[model samples]
Target: MPLAKDRNTLRRDGVQFSDPVAADTLIFAGALVCLDASGNAVPGATSTTLKARGVAQEQVDNTGGAAGDLSVESRRGVFQFANSTSTDQITRADIGSECYIVDDQTVAKTSATNTRSVAGVIRDVDSNGVWVEI
Candidate 1:
């Protein structure tokens, strides 16, 4: 069964699992990251770049003498992903709107000017941010 808003801790909070490793440098907390061709996580880049993956749950640095792959908590399934809005500015109507990957940590509500890859949908909106459900 699907979890309700109140009971959907995994949905609203994050139903995460540590799987993919960082493609290169370490990623910071709350950064909207994406997957590389190798299935490694990298900061969400432009539409012409990386594919939208998920919001990082925490930071991980596996480089610089670390011989192990850095793990990240990727939110899979239905979950809320918070991200900064682009220059377009977000509004309540943007809620339930389809957003696209703008940058490493940002999403845009409009694709009229840019034909970026679809990241997810804006399920909720705030002053300058939106909750995307991927």
Candidate 2:
């Protein structure tokens, strides 16, 4: 399975993806999205067994649907989100460091005692919020 003569390889931008939504999940537009332990899409939160994926592209209501019944569209990139708290705040000094998820719209400097999942790397901090590369 080696000698292939110019295979037409399929390509994707890798910036966007659609993932099956978890049961009872309602991911809002522009919310930080993550994959749960079962690889289902859910709103990012301060919980373990979650992996930050990207920002939700649009609101997807799956509150009554089971897993895989609906999917959410998300895009990976640097996005600004609300900072956490004084104790968990992300600062300019923390640039390029990993940030933790406080909720779909907030990120913290720590992992909330390792209960939170890694949201993304801190790209920049501003008066408005922290820019995270998800």
For model 2, what is the error of residue 51's alpha carbon versus the real structure, in angstroms, after optimal superposition?
0.5
lDDT of 1 by residue, 36-130 (tens): 66667776766554666677788876565232267778664433444544456667777777787767566776663676667777778765466
Per-prediction TM-score:
0.65, 0.97
Per-residue accuracy of model 2 over 1-134 as CA lDDT, tens digit each = 89559888899999999999999889999999999999999998889889999999999999999999999999999999999887898899999999999899999999877899899999999999999999
Model 2 alpha-carbon drift over 4 Å, by segment: none
* lDDT by candidate, in order shown: 0.66, 0.94
The lowest-lDDT stretch of 10 consecutive residues in candidate 2 is 1-10
> Best candidate per TM-score, number?
2
Clashes per candidate, residues 3 or more apart or on different chains? 0, 0
All candidates: CA RMSD (Å)? 8.0, 0.8
